[model samples]
Target: MVSVKSLHGSAQLLLDVAGGVTRIAERTHRTIVREINPLNRLRDIAGVPSKEREGQTYRFIQSTMSSLQQGLHRSLDGFSADDEPTHSVHSEKVAAALNGVCGDHLEASNNPLAITMHFRNSQGAKLRPDSSSMGATFPNAGPRIVVLVHGLCLSHEYWKGHNEADLGIELQRAHGFTPLYLNYNTGRHISSNGRELSEQLQILVDTWPVNVEELLLIGHSMGGLVIRSACWYGSEPKLPWTQLVKKALYLGSPHHGAALAKAGHLLTFVMHKFRYASPFALAQHTSAGIKDLRYGNLLDDDWEGIDQDEFHLDIRKPVPLLAGTRHYFLAATIGDHPTDFSSTLVGDLLVRLDSAKGHHSDALKKLRIRPEDCRVFEKLNHLALLDNKVVHDQIVEWLV
Candidate 1:
């Protein structure tokens, strides 16, 4: 059963997208029509045309759209009954998908799909560490805690694969370490999410019933970037949780930048160059979070004032691993072998080999990781890195 909130949110999203498309089409049509007519071009250049001479058809279109929007808003507002507080798994999955695609837009509009940070247990119930809820949240939580962070467009449920074996559960059984999963908005800027994560870790550590002896983080894909960002923020003032962190593992993370996002930037540039193709290029415009991944931006300043539509050299500052903490990277390739050309070009199908391994020409952008600490798993795609036994064994070995 779809919640009323979900239906309303979906309708609003569609209407917003349609409205934007209409505006873009109108603008494109006006540009082409005016450019094809020499008189309009001369008038535009000479600045001799009065305001009254402006296209009446364009004015009519704008007025009609405004009126329609007003009517829609009124209808929506009147029909609104509060949606159920609890969401079904299917609804949550749909919301997560929509958020991944246009989360930035949803957030800006204060939509219901905007995700928030929640610590969840194996059964997907929210965990609260307060006096009343701590016992229920962590009945067997130990001194050492391991936090699992999932990738973009994913929930904590992703950690539990089709197989009965999961890294978090295995770690708990083998090492007696308490496991907690972070569920957050993947569409937000990495740095923004990182800052929140840093603060949340502080709260988690400070409120733990047992004294935290050690902390470990395991992040996949964009989650890895978020973890790095959190470390960078957590170390500025030397947060208490930062000192407890013993090891951080990144799996299939694009440390430098993902190739697909860079390709999107290039496509956007090309589409913008041609006037007729400009409106169609609107489809390529993505959330700020996706744009930040183009260069693996980890700091707020990394993207400040940068033209997202234009191609620029990697200007991100190097974020070194936290002192006193050992960092390990695992990169996967879909190629038959590690040395194959396919592995070099398409790493794990989403990230490239060099990018995932933190290789860059710029010294400031390169992350220094010892060769022994890095591992490459062949014949595995990006998501497979999450559940592969070999990868799981390697992580266990490192942790032990």
Candidate 2:
């Protein structure tokens, strides 16, 4: 069943999108009007404006929407405080999907759909590191911990896999490593999420019932970027947990950059060139997190002073693999042969083969992974890296 909160949140999100479209339409109209007539440009400079103005109309619409949103919230608040909040898998999936798109906007506006970081179990119960909580939740928890971070538009539940073959469970059963799932907002900047993850890890380590001997990080897609960012932040401050990281594995991660994001940027730029299509370009103006993926940003400086609306040179500083940790990378391709042009270009459908392997023309930007440490799998897509038995076996071999 859909909760009233979910309905309200979705309604507000739709209203926000509509308002954005209106603003884009208004801007496009102004641009076209100014370009079509020299007098309109002169009037714009003279501050006289045009006869057909949308300022008043736009303001009125915004005010009305705001009032309606507030009224809905007030009405919802009138419900009995004793009513138990219910959880629905469908609602959670919808919320996660929305967060993956415009999550940064939702977070900035304090929307209810914004996700917070939490260590969750298969049942979606939050796991605290305290003795009582850990004892109850994970009675057989081991000293070595393996954290599984999901990609963009995904949840911790994804690591469970479509079949019964989950890497986390396999590691626990075969290797004595306890598995933990991290669920966070993927729409935030990698640096922002990284810093938060670093802090959270510190707390988790400090509060663990048993001494944490080894920490292994397994990240897929954007999750890999977040892990890298976290490691950078954690090391800079000399965080204690950083020392415990034994290995970090990236699965189909876009270390250099993702081609799809760059293509989206180019499309947005092209759309902006035409007045009528400018409004449609509003769809491309995604969250800060999505924009950062244009070049697998691992630090705040990678995105600092960069304009998300226009194309800019890659100003990101190099962030290498964390020291004292064995780094491994896995690249996947949809083609049957690794040498195929489609394999190199399409690369698991989202990431390219070169980017996933950290291969770059610039030596400084290139990740330092040994030839033996990286593997390329054929005929597998990005998500397949999470469930493939061969990949899981390889991970176990490395860990053991």
Candidate 3:
């Protein structure tokens, strides 16, 4: 169920996107017309009155659109209803995808479509960081806690499907560990989410129903980068949760960088080279979070005060794995063997095998994970790492 506020937000976003597209189209059309006729180009360069009139017409249209948008906004607010329905799982998935694409924009615009960070149960009910809420949420609370985090454009629902083969349930049944799922805006900067997560974990630990003797973290894809960022923040401030963390597992995570994200960056760079194609480049524009994936950035310094659209070298600040915590890497490849050319090149069709394994050609950037702690699964793709029985079994083996 989408709320009225969300509906308004969607309408507003659509209007903004339409305006942007129209402006781009107009620019492209003008460029084409000038190319077709040198006289028009000369007139445009000479500050012709016709061009000034055209500019005034465009501004008038823009002002009219702005007035209509404000009117619509005010009309929606006049309903004076607050009993909006909660989101369904399907709607949640859609919201997650939207948040992944332009969440930062949504947030800046105060759009209700932006997802807030929370610890949610299987049914998507947010859990408060208090003893009463924690006890109620986990009737069979235990000392050992494992937090499962999802990747970009995903929710906690990814870890537990409709079947009874959920890893969280299995961990509780087998090892007396309480499983917590974290849902957050994947479109925000990774370091921003990490700082927030670190603070949230502190509250969770302080208010747990039982003593948190052990803490474990499991992350898939971009979630792994968030965990890395969180760990950096925790260790820098000597957070108590950092001391409790026993192990951190990264499944199909691009520790070095994701191949697809790098390719997209390169594509955008190429698009900027052609004046006619530059307008289309707006379609390729991504959020700050996606840009961070190009080099697995884990800090704000990596991108602060820089033009995001401009081509830049990998400026990621290296963060070492948390000390006194066992860090494990689990990567999957479509190839039948880990050493195959496809595995080395394509690597689960999204991340390269070397990137997933935390390998970097530069010594300063390498994670230096022990070879014994890393595992690669052949004949499996990136998403398959979340649901495969073999993968689950291997995780269990590592946990025990």
Candidate 4:
């Protein structure tokens, strides 16, 4: 039998060990987030234009920042990974570095965001034909086509982080892929904007605006699911799927559902239990938050396909579900988990691996994607992965 004194001593030792490890890891992550992270977000001199004409892109975009200033609206705050209070000194230093380093880009990320979602309806003109139809010239290659979709509460500027463009450059040089940033109302249902997106893809592919070998899509958070929904519905649209898409990747995407969203809903029901914050919070019931609520049930057996009725959005295109495409899942799991069930702590602080992969969905189980189809990278999170160069490197490798 164990003596009481010995048991007490062992418990204390274990606690001390756990505390030490947590402290070390938190500090390491803090250093990484504080140091390397801002570098990824830098817009100053990170990208060098291939030619003199291209340099204007930076100067042009930077000009927009001259008129922009910080806007007042509280974004959700994250507690330190260390669970300790944030030091004002560190905060000030980080802020100063950003202002100095990023220059215009820093100003853009700070506040008064820029919204760049201007796309035209270029539908149906035959962008692809395997030689015999439009000669071998069609759908071969050109400037290249790329699609970028942003996550919640953000605009295309999210990807404007010069680090993001670095990824784009890699895609172009290595795989001959171009960049196209997609912007949609974060408040709309998946199906609503999804069908619209599919239609857009169809048009983008059908037209011979440029020779294109591959159509790549990069979506973060809800953006990932939106892309899937578009692909699912787009495959059978009037235009057809193969004409448009090639491959897609999801970063920190909650393909299954969000755990924090589920928890937040409970709090939303009990007013006093939770404080009403951003319109992004739960105030907009029909927003992405609500969409996330019903999102988990997406794997329902009847989920063979989704449309306006199921998601409560106006689906502009026909909802003919496709089987599955050569898609890849790149999730930024929390990385270091000191627990038995790593899945729980796997995703960014808010999302778990299981939910991000749509594993939590009974609906998806009956569908094409099985357990084997997923790939998780534990080093990323919702925001970090976007600016993180390592994440872009992996994407370039896969796309190429």
Candidate 5:
């Protein structure tokens, strides 16, 4: 739901974006102008007499625009001081997309548009960590608890599979496993989200309606990385939720790293090295969460205080699979067969097969999973992992 505060936050964000784009365009114009304008070059040789005057004009214009923006922000604040209107599904999708791009900035700036992590049911109602609340949400609550986490730029709403049947619904109907969907901002650092999830799971387990016999976690894409991060933190503190976890499944997860994110990092690095491309590089401001996918960072030390724009060696700390929990790595390929070259080069069109299977060139980084635990589905892309019937059947079979 979109709140009044969200609208205010959106206005502020739009103003910030406009200002950033204006600055980038201005710099690019200045760079091109300096190279092409003989008069400007001559002025540069004669100590830049015109640039100072141009700078003054630019500053004046910027001041005027800033003042106008502030006025608009204040007006928006006053207009929606008390009312919050619910928006359509399209708006929610847009919000999710925005969170994926700059969620860290929105959070750091205290923007109400930033998404807060929470648990929800199949119907999209918020789930609370208490016996009565759990009973109310799930009257058929069972001992087996299933936690489903969605991927980047997605929500719990995206889990609908064939015949509009989501994994949660099928798990409950088939195996009496009560399911909880984790809804969170995909733009924050994976380690940060993982730590919070560990804490939240602790509370949920402590206050569950039924005695939890076993807990199973299923994550798709970036969600798998978040699950790994959470498991690492939970085990580090010996959290009770970690002990309850029976199996953790990674569906098309980039355990080692994602190829697209690596390509993006390389592109940004290359652009940063050149003068003309530097300003454009500023336009590629990605969230910390997106940056973490470069080498699948799961710890704070991997990224904190480091220059994100520069290319660096993969210094990610090795995190092993959760002890006493069965782990499954499910990968997919656009190829029709496993032996096809496309399967190796473009696993699911976003993650490579080796990465999804937790295979690393370095032995220290590879996940310790049995050969039988890894499965691949051919002729399927990354997004198809969410909705395909065969994928659902495979997951169910594994759980069974």
Candidate 6:
């Protein structure tokens, strides 16, 4: 008995209802958790009755109370990690802890802040593109600039400082390349930030008054995917390589897609159902999330971030970046359990060899990608690829 227009109207109303329900549900759940957390803490302090008691009746009551307390804690805590801080410190503090950058700012910055530094300042951000005074320098006389991008849920701190020269110092010393680390929020959708990153890079190139002889790019984990996405948008045959990028190197880049991101997608499903998940819940199933794991988003515009219907990065899809740009790729991986299932619990306490490689390599092959790439090392985790002296030396030999 319903006409087409009525059906359309009904659909729209249903959509609105669903949206309202989800938003209210999430907020109410969060609030209830906030209120009950203190109660549970007090219960802990007061000493919940022990399961093992002196009398028979006392033992039954104690055991029941213990079970109740456990349930209460689970209900209140939800998916939040035990002992995790409710509030985050300032960005400066995060930066210092991650890389020792801005001490004073760390005291002022707060959580959910973009993990990455803005190469452009507040004033520059406000100015017209033509009027902005932001500086971008690519000096021919001094060292070459190498920008390092970090992976998901991580800061540049992921670049361990153990190996001689580390990745940055080694690249600088061996190739006369200066290292620049780029940090950004991993929580946002990948392409949204990637397009932003492309513009940021363009702005950077414009501000640099120096004549850049060459530009070398490096990325870790999700950072690898961002560089790829950036190149996809920015590269063109008409553009002169000399005017912009020269070479890009991906360490543990997920060229196809990542396995961990697939797990994240699954987790997002569970979290959404339970309504007690972190904002990171979206991080798991988003298109950007899938892309970071090595699944390519070739067929659709994934920025909208819809669920299973969303397109992923097609690993085997022909890359859009120009061929002559001297692009190099390296892969890293770990075990299979958390390895294939969770990016959080992968190999070497960091990345699985498979995730690192974006391909299955039993021995954790370290190889150069492009024009018949070479595998230099056989066994190293994602972090080791950056922090290990051997990897740095290998990179130097190739660049030189």
Best by TM-score: 2
- What does candidate 2's lDDT look like per residue over 185-216, in tens digits? 88999899899999989888887778899989
Better of 4 and 6 by TM-score: 6
- Candidate 1 contains a number of clashing pairs equal to 0
Local error of candidate 5 at residue 400 (angstroms): 1.8
Tens digits of per-residue lDDT for model 1 on 94-211?
Answer: 6776766678888887665678887887677887757458666776668998899988787777787657567898898888878888988888888988999999999888888778
Q: Which residue window of length 10 is worst by lDDT in model 2?
A: 77-86
Taking the tens digit of each residue's C-alpha lDDT, what string does model 6 give over 1-400?
3333223323433343344445455455544554678864465467865332134643455455456545544554343333333322243334334322221121232221224444322111222233134233222324256777776655554564454345766677677875666766654445645666677666655555455567677887667767766766666423333245677777766554555556656566666665345433544323234433435442226434444523333333344544556766664444333335443345444444444444433222222345444342444566567676666666777787
lDDT of 3 by residue, 7-98 (tens): 88788888777777777777787778779999888987888875463555567767777886797688787654457677777888888898
Q: What residue runs in model 3 are displaced by over 4 Å at the alpha carbon?
A: 33-54, 77-82, 162-164
Whose TM-score is higher: candidate 1's or candidate 5's? 1
TM-score of each: 0.91, 0.94, 0.92, 0.54, 0.89, 0.55
Candidate 4 clash figure, as a count? 10
Question: Residue-wise lDDT of candidate 4 within 198-240, one digit each (tens)?
Answer: 7766656665455556677778877776776777666545455
Give per-model CA RMSD.
2.8, 2.2, 2.7, 21.8, 3.4, 16.7
Error in Å for residue 163 of model 2? 1.9
* Candidates in descending TM-score order: 2, 3, 1, 5, 6, 4
Pick the winner on TM-score between candidates 2 and 4: 2
Better model by TM-score, 3 or 6?
Answer: 3
Q: Extract clashing residue pairs from model 4.
A: 127-206, 146-180, 148-180, 148-182, 256-358, 299-362, 299-363, 299-364, 300-363, 334-346
